[model samples]
Target: MAGTGGSNPSSAAAAPKILLAKPALVTAAKYNRGPGGGGGPDDSNRSRLPSVAFLNLLSDSWDFHTDRFLPFLTDNTDFTVVGVIGPPGVGKSTIMNEIYGFDATSSGMLPPFAIESAETKSLAKHCTVGIEPRITSERIILLDTQPVFSPSVLADMIRSDGSSTISVFGNESLPAELAHELMSIQLGVLLTSICHIVLVVSEGVHDNNMWRLMATVDLLKHNLPDPSSLSLSHPQSSDKEIKDKIQEAGEEYMASPVFVHTKLHERDSAPGYHVQVKKALNQYFSSTSFNKPSVDGGSDPTPLDLYFIPCKSNSEYQYESYYSSFWKLRDQVLSMSGPSFSRTVSERDWLKNSGKIWELVKGSSTISDYCRTLQNSGLFKR
Candidate 1:
């Protein structure tokens, strides 16, 4: 099954014969079926219930038997599958440890699954993953690429050892210059995920990242989905993988109600981990069951009310250059962008900024006059 809120306990009490079909992982992902042909529980007598969202801990070779598999998404200790992205050293492990309670201070609990390279490290295998509440009848599982900040590293790992990484990289659009491509693509995916996304970077925010967000906004707004389902065999990918690509863009972010907590570590007493997420849910997530803050900041949601996670937890200076680089470009564009830009400006800065600006702003005075001068630039329109 793709995912589940909870299995019906009553199904077992009813003396139902549990279907014990050990379908291969690939088949499960492809068809979301048990050994039989359908999604129904193995024993038809059992009341049909959703399957728990399976966490796929992929590596150069997937390490399925890791300690502390589920991440703590909210105050009540919500359980959700988190995909860590980044090169090996960019703190994917460290971040996962922090979020999923992988305490080096203590042993952890490990769920049994297919794990490669089992000899690599010691698993704590102590703590239990929290029970998660069912939100939507439709599966609302979270799937992400690892190492939030190291887009370059994840790309490199995928390109070099991709044959062993996952079939998605093998049979998919391989990027040119993978250094940060995988991370970027994956971030783009979380930007559109089903649950709240916490894109953690050791460094602060940048313009390029915002542009990435805007690109998603534009595409989704224009009725385009990345790797648009129309272009690929939609029925083949696992539900988790499909959820990975849904970048959760809303019509609101275009108008600026989206609140971001960049350089979270830099914040002075940033409300601890739980408070911050609760605040984010009130800010970003819109649901009827949950309490939402008003636009005017009327009230706040409790810690248990939010569900968010850390995608990047940069420890060193790895993502610093990336953040700086994007900001430089972002500042240049925002320097002249309109209230509503038809084109999200990144991949075309030189032509769009210098060449286009020279044609538009050369006759202008200073930065103060940049925006107005660009009105007639005819660049964004072009």
Candidate 2:
């Protein structure tokens, strides 16, 4: 049976109300089952939800006790998983906590899956090692994943000679670099598969972290369902054909990533910053062989919305107090609703299905095979 942590009735009612009140302000994410049937710190004392580790999903030693977790997700159809993907120490957790209403001062009842502020610091090591889920509202579940591409993952790739060495589940095609960057790849897989809206966090506009987004976007475009007739031949026979297909397919099948530029205070917040960032992104997208954004800001939904926020509460510099800026961001996320995505996955099923994908990722032997698994995972199908 799924465990609700023996939660109370009043708490349950409040979470759903928050989720349903603003139908557009919603999100969801992935988690792997563990032997203990839960992940992260014991939130019993703090009255918060436990965030799970993704590495646990890859461990053969840990038993995936789905019964304890699936009940939370299975009990509702309206749950929307939201996740943040970016480099290490970029305020992904800070952004997540704010979105989920993890305020220390609020007197109102906490949301159903309220997350604890993710452990953070200035150190370079990865803080979030796995996917952590918290029910923010009755229908809104927020997932905070480990940084997709961190220095640690990069080091692992270098040490492995650009070879994918980690496998706990199935033969998969994936680049050595991507395989080593498991957290990002897994987050990419989850966002592409299950999430409703993804807040793509970054340190700043010029930060190299955008490369992570670029790679994930490329993966998404590559995995788009091939038409029956096109399967007989390489539909992408030409650059023009490739671009045309992507546009025609539309972005509805992909997770609508709203880029949130963090650490805004450190950079010159001149009037030209937004314009400069947009221009740079436009140029970057156009240069890509495929999956380019519309240069004219055309009707095509290729490029996503981008916004800026100052510092997060956890920042070492605390460049500026972010309480007001944080709420502003919350309001924006609540208002901007995009195209619906993926199949109607009950919360319980999401947990089970995500675990299956992890297994496949673990079993793969080559980068190409892992990529194939991700594309064929069928999480992106509408």
Most accurate candidate by TM-score: 2
User: For candidate 2, which ten residues in a row score worst on lDDT?
Assistant: 16-25
Where does the lowest 10-residue lDDT sum fall in candidate 1?
126-135
lDDT of each: 0.28, 0.49
lDDT of 1: 0.28
Tens digit of per-residue lDDT, candidate 1, span 112-139: 1212133432331211121111111111
TM-score of each: 0.32, 0.60
lDDT of 2 at 40: 27
lDDT of 2 by residue, 59-112 (tens): 322123444334344334444567677777677776776776564564533332
Candidate number achieving the greatest lDDT relative to the actual structure: 2
TM-score of 1: 0.32
